[model samples]
Target chain A: MATGNISHGRILSIQSHVAYGYVGGKAAVFPLQCLGYDVDVINTVNFSNHSGYGRFGGSRASAQELSQIFDIMDQNGLLYPERLLTGYVPGAEATEAVTALAQRLRHRSPKLIYLLDPVLGDSGRLYVSPDVVPIYKNALHLATIITPNWFEVEVLTDTKITDAVSLRQATQVLHQTYHVPHVVISSIPLKSWLLDLLPAHLHPASASASTSEHLACIASSRQGSSSTVYATCFPCLPGYFSGVGDLFSALVLAHFTDEPTTEGETSLSRAVSQAVSKTHAMLVLTHEAAAALPEDERTVTDEELDVREPIRKIRRMRGRELRLIQGQDIIRGTQPIEFRRLQAWDTFWDA
Target chain B: MATGNISHGRILSIQSHVAYGYVGGKAAVFPLQCLGYDVDVINTVNFSNHSGYGRFGGSRASAQELSQIFDIMDQNGLLYPERLLTGYVPGAEATEAVTALAQRLRHRSPKLIYLLDPVLGDSGRLYVSPDVVPIYKNALHLATIITPNWFEVEVLTDTKITDAVSLRQATQVLHQTYHVPHVVISSIPLKSWLLDLLPAHLHPASASASTSEHLACIASSRQGSSSTVYATCFPCLPGYFSGVGDLFSALVLAHFTDEPTTEGETSLSRAVSQAVSKTHAMLVLTHEAAAALPEDERTVTDEELDVREPIRKIRRMRGRELRLIQGQDIIRGTQPIEFRRLQAWDTFWDA
Candidate 1:
């Protein structure tokens, strides 16, 4: 799966495009472009804003429309995309169209790297149609890299990820069952052992540990070799962000594709570390901007106001969209933040 | 029309989105976001590539689809866009739909600043359908700022723009006839006097003068006051470049809406000068990149190969798409380019 020294390659990104907020295509395109990749976006849905706002408006692109767009590209002999990225397709029909498009593109460019972010839902829920899950389960075999949240990993593998051991088992099932070469589980809830891997000074006190600490783990397996998994954890901001996963996946893709494979720091660990650091920096900036909003502007509904959890209260506040544009410097890597990497371990769960 | 010191306002951008090339929405969205504005984009057409390739693929968004998308936004109460920008609508139906959308948006928010880039054609040609012209003429009255090339100004005002005098007359007619307040006639063909207005060292000799030198002129007519026009000239790089106009309009809108009106530098002259400088910088970058391509990659058709004109020869060479993402630092204003402003003058042509 390793392609050597290809820079400035074209990326075919299929996702949703929102007019008012950062999510899906809106979240991914700008950051990838900032990293100097030519991104071709096929929007699965066009929405007025991210649904996290409690209100959103837009229409989904029909499967026929999607096919028509692809036909034009096919006719023009422009089908070779070095990487194909699938984000948020709304329904079963769009998902099928995207899968067919990806298969066709893969057939044309055999070395093409496909990264699928299985955006079904998060936090024990499914936002997309149930029919879409089967499509993703089948499409996982075609993906070179699969980025899913812990919940999505659980859903896809039909496993309960209660602890670190179960998480490892789920990843093993993903690799063995779907033949996915690389799996990156983003925003995974950190456990005690994972926290112990970090330097003592960076780790939060166990007494005050909350659900806000997260680790993003990247696992890769090769034939005739043991699977190796590396993880990096950063303190998650105390709120729900609409597009953090989208942004993180884009940054990882850009780093993994743009950097020379021969470089020592171009390993998966280093790329994940950089991606986590940037995502953390952006989150910090967005949180700060939200905190600075006028009290009236940050007002929440009565139901939200009664919530005791600080994270919940923060999530319900109005005008809490990610400050992506305001934090462009961080995306450009002009402003740097530190991220701590955990020790790499061999897969211990049975395959 | 004057709104002061509003930072990070939202912009509603209606334009064409191309998958493979930087033009229309593809060109405008990133730069505006880089400038720290929340941009909501409604793509008028989705194409495989810009038409400059001599052959391309794509489909236009139907009026019903546009209305459906807008309906969602309207239902969600997300209609207030600080600035509304229209670019590259392909047909009469889309034009009418956008006009109605703009009217509804303006009625809801009277302070909305509408900037219309009448992308009819260039170099004395009409690339869009003839029916679009009448639509544009009617829509012009609704725009606060109208950016048109000299050719478009001629078409809209029904007058030929031969000299600086006629150019002023054309703009005057635009203001009085259409009631547009701020008329920016981008890419006006420069005469000798206008060329003399540029710094002497930057000027080319009279013997080699062609239709390549263009002045970007901004004309403003406020009530009970004389019309004032300011112009700046940059040597237009040879060859057809797509999306320069779109990029220019986005930059202008960003500067106008983001910068503090009270600051001396935030005047219309400063905005136009900065926009032109950035556009020129990008053009220079693109031309250099095109020139550096391998000779085999620069091969052209037999008809193009026989052309003796250097500009024509350069235009015919293959692989000439704007290197926008590579040159994004200029858009971010990290690499500064200097542009000189010509003296301001009152309209001198008789109506």
Candidate 2:
């Protein structure tokens, strides 16, 4: 791997953009730019805000528009980005368009590191059209890395990830059957029973694992026949936060390189650990900021908001948006918080 | 003025966004984020790249689309941005939409600082339709600050600015007749004849004025009957750089505050000096990066590119795009370079 490419990278990121809040490209673009990458974005949906509020205004980019943008990019030699990131395309046609775009980008730059965040749905609900599922599945083989949350893991692999064992099995299916070189399950809700499913060495201490306060991130890297898995557990912040997954995937691209620096560490695991650490710190900052908002302006947790009243829902959602701008110091690595729990989970993925 | 507002400003910026290079919002957004401002953007034009390349792809957002976005923002209570920045709206209808949006924003947040960049054209060319001129002229009174280059100054105030004296006169018209609170003539071409028109104290040294190596930036702030103008002169690099105005206006918003810090210094003047200094440094860094590219990859000066062949034009344009990502240190103010010479030109505006 070339050191120059890792330090000074160029990425063409296709994602949704909200005019008033941070989500999708809004969440992803700035951190990458701060980390010293030229990120060129094609906005998949131009909304006033994310739909987590139950209502948003703005239209999605059509398949034809995507093709037109790509055509000009190709004509102008703007397709030579070192990385390509795709997230949150709204429709089936647009999904297919993005898949075709990924294929074209890979064809142009054979060494292109394509990080596909298969943004189908999360938390057992499908936010995108059902047709987007097969499209994302078919495009999986083209990805250098795929960052999927627990719900997406179940949706993509046709398996239920109720515990650690099932989650590991689904990730292995992505590595072996789909031929994805790397897989990062972005988050898993670690219930007490689910914690028991992990191997003894990988388990959290009894005092730390008391409630459902901890969530885990698992990463796997496959090089030829050998594959390695690593997991890190961190305490989850209360309340709803949009764009954590987008930010995590973006950080993975920024920190990812196949060159391992020290013993007992793979580059994929190290990158995942760094991304997870930064994301956790940023979320803590965001949570604190949201909590500090005046009582009248504060948002209720996701469980508390009434879904029927869109106006009330949108108002509450505003206070819950991620404070990416405020967390610039952490995103740029000036304030590094190392959440160290990256341990080998190779036992779960026996050859 | 509230310190909390200054440290955590929220801005609604309506500008162009391109998928490939740094221009318009692409040039402005990241730096503001690095400076700790939450910037929400409405992309006026979505293009493959800036039009400097002669031919590019993508469509401009329509007047209806802008209205739709604003309607949703208003409905969702996302309308209370602390700052509103507008640049490069394509047609008359869209310009009106932006003007209406500005009016609504000001009505909601009376303390809102509106920075309007009348992006009419450069040099002597009119890239936008002539119809956009009257709409911009009528909307000048709504801006707290208007940053326009020499050509836009002429087009907006209907006065030809051949030298510093005429430039000052045109800016006064914007301050007096149009009722704009502040004006920043982003650039002035410093020809030897133009140098002769300046008051003695504002003139550069004869040795330094031997050639037209320098350009001038003049800023004026009006408070009732009293208005002060300040001038700073810096050497101009020999290349066509895009988005200097957008970046300048964005920085001015980030730095500007009405409260005077010390004797003989207005907050407006201090902000202008910092913005001009940072812009100059970033341009120097960008020019050096362009020069260091491989010989075949290097672009010729704007005058050297043949307009008849667009393929050659775009190929050359590739190397000339701003290196905003690489210059993140300077943009984020981690590497500060203070370029002094913000002399008070109050003599030009004596009662």
Candidate 3:
């Protein structure tokens, strides 16, 4: 638990590397590192490529094999202080071990951030085996933050969040129901009641009628004195690299646990947001260049995707209060300002 | 069968819509038609994204539900496909139905090019469910051009192809074994084999000494003509995109089925190479862009992914008679070629 101070050693992330870079901790660990969080990953499955190709080395790990690594980590005292982030836990064995690991982490350091990128349905459909959702539901309470897309938010909260109000209602229920105070409903496509109060110029959703439909996406940075300067962004574009949630959570956990000097208003929200922007810029710039190249050159572009793009970089996390940015917010610099003030969402202590 | 010549007809192609666009005929289809093939597609499975995103809606396709579309097509006499291009046949039913359709087409026209992009494995690993590969094996004889990557080729030929000699030998066996004459091994990375025939100069197995040691990827346009000039190139970079096979097949089908006046060469090899260059360009233009965007905007660009981005446009199909490059080649392409050598692989009839 000593790692929880300024220099948190690393985060122990376990995932189903069933597909290559799209899911699991492969995508998550990188951005976390970018935000200064070291991550050690254990892949449950090493696929030739993702399953979508309909041609891959079928699932390789019996949950038992996957757990052996975790068991070793546990034996080595690695899990003690380091946070845990998991995505797409494949079989019953993986599910069983990960849930246990989460508990162990909690017992070891109640402050350990168990961030789960509950990669469930996107655009009204579930991607994981429905059988696994329940297991994921079980891990809900252990997580400090559960970042789900709209469909997942709906599933976790059992509420259909098709609109903004419902989304907020769902975010509340998600945090309330799961007790994971910080809830980020990524890709949520609507404006919220809170954004109405921020400067009309800073409300990004209002400026671009085109961008207003973005699903709700949140990343809280350092806890501050004045207020968590909640910031919000409309994904300037769509089709971002997969596995971004993993990255965002790792970033949030690193910044929060590190006790970084996120001045009052600027908070961890701003710092994480900048991390996200840096990751996004890295992905986007590479992708543009890749797009410029011939197909033969296409390869794994990012360890984690630029989940949110071109959003202003959040730097001064300590004291700056978050203000609403207009849809033109994307045109602004990359800075993470806590944008949303949800009684439901929290980065650290739930109470 | 008579409709094959109809520039615009519902070429009911069966493939998967890579929840995202890693596969299926999504982004590549438009570019293909831009190359000149009227294409209508049916997804065998609707995944959350590419299987690589861990998973989404675990490959759900009841045989009955999958066949409904084809059943309807049967009623409309549209089942008699002039050209059938297939990639990643999901389940037993899809494989059988497509095979049956291809068989019927051959029976009726004997000239129907069932260009099968045998998507089974890559780099010596299988991604398809066990049940699917065997079915594909059975259907291989029904395809004219069996385009397999290095791994799939090895699986089918049972020959460990190392150098150009082995490749040539393997091609013959593949042609003989699968009953197809044209065996296009995409992106062969061996630099020695690729002296003049260059592109995707990706060398899969070269030692570190002056060897890229990257996968040898070949983007080629094959024509069924006397002077077969394969326009082979490597992206000269390292990356992996799953649905690339689907796009390649679509490109080959598009190029050979049309006539043109673009350049000097008049051969199937050149034609296939041209398709490879064009497809490579489209992939290059879209791949990283997709990496940068979310699930949707990946295909649509900041402006437009001009299929005419120098590399994407097919100025002409060389190596036989006519060497003309038309918009149909770039604006609306994606059907079988005018010649018929590759068909030998897809069918067991008189080659």
Candidate 4:
């Protein structure tokens, strides 16, 4: 029974809800429930909105408080996880505890998938602590697949990356150094995309020419064996919003879990590309929803027509109707508009 | 001899840092510093990165740990603050104790300014624990200004707002019910450049595009001061970063001190707006500096460009040289391309 059996075990994700009050975890939980994953999220911190935009409700719980959560999980036998997809683990102590948990999982099951969205720095900068870099270093080996932006890739591997050549070079170094099998570098700002030296697509043009559609997708290459570079760009019509990574991580995990027959199907390149495509589509559709409204009133709600009350509106989408959830992309600004939700897995191939 | 000389005092704040390590007291202290006030911050939470993103670090500090901070402040004679600006006070026990502190501030300084963000939920959403909201409500009556997004405003005021009429209607009830002089209803998707919607202007795309440029300025009117709404928008830009309220509250205390001469100049509307403008400009100029870089490697570091490193990597145009400290904006998302260490008093103007 142990010989190459596709195991259907539990995945416990320890991440923060990158939402203000209603959308992040509150809204996130709905799609999670729809995806058929027994998800128990340890909200490291909950604010009124994502920290990127900078205002939110207060915070509760300390990093030490998370240890208590693990204790509770142990008391209820909930810690028997087959996979631990850690998202935003708050601080040094929590990282230590999580590293210990990774060691524990290695001992407990030996094959638990640890997909880490190394939520640290972005856009050629590290936003957290210098102390955190080392903690994440410990995690690099523990993680089966590590998701980092171009900036973090450089920090982790200490390689100056600029293009596909350098990105793969850094990814290779990262994989070898960290001992993680797969590394996906996201948001690598291309030279072409920089709107007048935008530098990593952080540029805003003097005026909006229908809002340029920029994308940062996932890519990878098989070491010394494959004939291709694993890369895909998932572009979106840009307007700032938070929690894209949280949603992406959830989608990747769901997709991995969805394919019951194969634990490793295709390279990380394909999986992330597909995931990015889906995410980009969802974002586009969200924009269309916003565009349909008065410019000032454009925002998406999981519920229908919240036009009557718009003050407590969400900046991001909270996609309800999981069964309706399809692999079809949400309407992008430029893409075909009829974005239907996932009715079946076939949508992925068809799309 | 004691002819009501404006009471000299200090306030303290404590919170987390995003990219850097342990921005503890700075979250609270820096804001007060902007207002030309002295402060001491007791960091209850210390992490490598903020919890908004997927931070991988530890959090250490307990009630006992917090008490040690208070002990230090007590020993140093910094506890006799005339006002207190509290943001992101984590834990139920801390909430309980803070209520007591709010009460103590009033008792110790008869005219103490207690400005609470009451960060339960913005945009009609709740992010904290079910218990935390109630705890916030308990402390609301003691607040001089309770700044919440529209979502939180509704929950506190129990109003069904659809238009300006309802918003005004809701504002009256909030002031009457909460007894807080000013209620900064944030993220109120409206089309007014008036002074009252300072909080909304702080949010993104919540107002008209034409009116959104002049940030940090207030479109404000006091409670029951309907005729006070002005057509001209105030410009106090650099107030776009996270935890600016924490800073604003600190400034308000100093500006609104019980002095006769400074009283006229230190109007709440004027100081907050001025601080807002300075913060906005700091962040904006930083972005412009970042934009000024060469294409492709526009996201260059000071070390990369062979220029003297701005302390916070953000540059503020201080006379002939660009100064970079830890600059932030009162409004989120509208972060300056760089940071500066300039103060609100250094940049803001009278209404």
Q: Which DockQ values do the candidates obtain, in the order shown? A: 0.38, 0.54, 0.01, 0.01
Model 3 bad stretches (over 4 Å): A1-7, A18-23, A33-38, A52-54, A58-60, A191-201, A205-209, A212-216, A219-229, A238-240, A258-268, A295-351, B1-351
TM-score of chain A of each: 0.86, 0.92, 0.70, 0.70
- Give one digit per residue, the lDDT tens place, for model 3 in B230-285: 33334343344456667666766665544543453333454465556555544444
TM-score of each: 0.86, 0.94, 0.40, 0.42
Candidate 1 chain A least-lDDT 10 residues: A1-10
Colliding pairs, model 2: none
Please state the Cα-based DockQ of model 3 relative to the true two-chain complex: 0.01
| CA displacement after TM-score superposition, residue A80 of candidate 1 (Å) | 2.6
Q: For residues B1-351, what per-residue lDDT tens digits would candidate 4 score against the true structure?
A: 111112144554544332121122333443343233434344445343333222234454455545544543343233566667776766767676767667766777767777676656543556567677767777788877665656776776667666546666666665665566655543444345332443332333334544544322222334363312211232333212344444444443444444342432324545444444444454455455445555542333345443443322222111111112324223221343322221122111123
Alpha-carbon runs more than 4 Å astray in model 1: A1-7, A191-207, A211-225, A257-266, A295-318, A346-351, B1-7, B108-110, B191-225, B257-266, B299-318, B346-351
lDDT, residue A308, model 4 = 49
List the pairs of residues colliding in candidate 1: none
| TM-score pick, better of 1 and 3 | 1
lDDT of 1 by residue, A152-199 (tens): 998999998876567667877888888887788877666666554434
- Residue-level lDDT for B115 in candidate 3: 77
User: RMSD, model 2, all Cα superposed?
Assistant: 2.9
Worst 10 residues of 2 chain A by lDDT: A1-10
